[model samples]
Target chain A: GGIITQTPKFLIGQEGQKLTLKCQQNFNHDTMYWYRQDSGKGLRLIYYSITENDLQKGDLSEGYDASREKKSSFSLTVTSAQKNEMAVFLCASSKDWGANTLYFGAGTRLSVL
Target chain B: AQSVTQPDARVTVSEGASLQLRCKYSYSGTPYLFWYVQYPRQGLQLLLKYYSGDPVVQGVNGFEAEFIKSNSSFHLRKASVHWSDSAVYFCAVSPNYGNEKITFGAGTKLTIKP
Candidate 1:
């Protein structure tokens, strides 16, 4: 079975600092996505990549940027961390661009102070 | 825009008791619905999904969900829940056309007491 690996399970950043999270999936899925989960809120999509170098903006992509440098790796960047901000960033991949099943990574928790 | 709603924020049930979690969605056309479970500090795992054909779909851990198009609801249910069933459940939906970006509900935290 393939696994989705996310780096730096816990992340702490100072206010106004830039932070990055990385994800790698060995499933060789064609579509990758970045989602944010806030306390008491549903998971919201940030950005998605259909293939290498392809990017699509989701409803909550304002302060975030994503890159799919390779088919197996996708990364998310927070332009500027806000104070008192805490959330979990989740990475998911699917075999197809349609409504296929998704495999998720363990997630990276971010804390801004 | 497609949206999902999970009315209950938290539910407590005793072990071996029947379980039911409600989920509702707003969509214009045919909808693709899914139920996902997330254990404490763990990633979300797909429990069941409904696309077409059958309205009822069975999933892992003896979980199942029934999609009622007339009511725009897809509720998850289990015959007998276990203590390990304590987790957060999310309901999600994707539009039938265009992009496949999924919209999720706020989630319902299930606490199964032994």
Candidate 2:
């Protein structure tokens, strides 16, 4: 069994601060994605990487940046945190793209003050 | 654009009662549907998926979902409810053949009343 590990289960940041969250998966999946979950907005994709060094922006990629340093690691950075932007960041990976079941990390909760 | 709509934002039922959560999706061609559950302060867990073949797909924890293509809906059902089943359920859809570019609905929060 493979597990998706997310670092710093909770994040507390000040407004305008640039916070980074990390994700690591041992499943060796080819695709990794980062999503932001608001209270009632569901989950919005921020970015994804098909492979190491590859990146694709999703619907909610405006204030975020992602990096797939290695096949096992994917990281996301919040450009400038806002008070209203406090939400949970989730990381997921899939064996392949589309219609495939996704493996998810526990997620990192961000609170902006 | 591919999208999902979960009409009920919150649903409450008593233990041992039947459970149903609604999900509607939008896509021009054949669509890929999925139901995921998230426990408090946790990540989303795949409950079931519908692609091809049988209209009814079974998932973990005795959960099942039926895909009604005619109605453009996929609804999750469980015969008996348990307190552990309390969680936030999300419905999502993908346009392409596979899981590409998926969109999620706002999600339905299920609460079990004893």
Candidate 3:
């Protein structure tokens, strides 16, 4: 079975610092996504890449940027960390672009001091 | 403009009891619905999905969900829940196929009593 791996399971950043989260999937999926989950809130999509170098903005993409350098990897960047901000960033991928099943990574918890 | 709503924030049920969690969605087109489970500190796992054919779909761990298109609701049910069923459940909806962003509900925390 293929796996989606996320780096730095726990991330601690200082206020105003830039942070980066990386995701790699061995499934060779064509579509990848980044989402943020806040306490007591549903997951919000930040960015998605349909293919290499392709980017799409989701509802919550204001402070985030994403890149798909290759077919198997997608990365997310937080422009600037905010104090007292804490959330989990999740990475997911699907074999196809349309409504298909998605496989997810374990997620990275971010805490800004 | 698509959204999903899970009315219950938390539910407590005794082991071996039947369980049901309510989920409502708002979308203009034919909706694609899904139920996902998340154990403590774990990633979300797809339990079941509904996309046009059968209204009822069975999933892992004896879980099932029935989609009521008329009511715009998809409710998850389990004949007999176990302690292992304790987790957070999320309901999600997407407007159309292909690379569309899915909207998720706030989630319901299920606590199975021993």
DockQ scores for all the models shown? 0.68, 0.74, 0.70
In model 1, the runs with Cα more than 4 Å from the true position are none
Candidate 3 C-alpha lDDT tens digits along A26-93: 99888899989987898988999988778999889998888898999999999999999999999999
Model 3 TM-score (2 dp): 0.97
Give the CAPRI class of candidate 2: medium
Worst 10 residues of 3 chain A by lDDT: A94-103
Error of 1 at A79 (Å): 0.9
Instruction: Name the docking class for model 1.
Output: medium
RMSD of each: 1.0, 1.1, 1.1
- What are the per-candidate TM-scores when only chain A is compared? 0.98, 0.96, 0.97
Estimate the overall C-alpha local distance difference test score of candidate 1: 0.92
Q: What is the TM-score of each candidate against the true structure?
A: 0.98, 0.97, 0.97
* Model 1 steric clash pairs: none
Q: In candidate 3, which residue ranges exceed 4 Å CA deviation?
A: B97-99
Clashing pairs in 3: A97-B98, A97-B99, A98-B98, A99-B98
Whichever of 1 and 3 has more TM-score, that candidate is 1
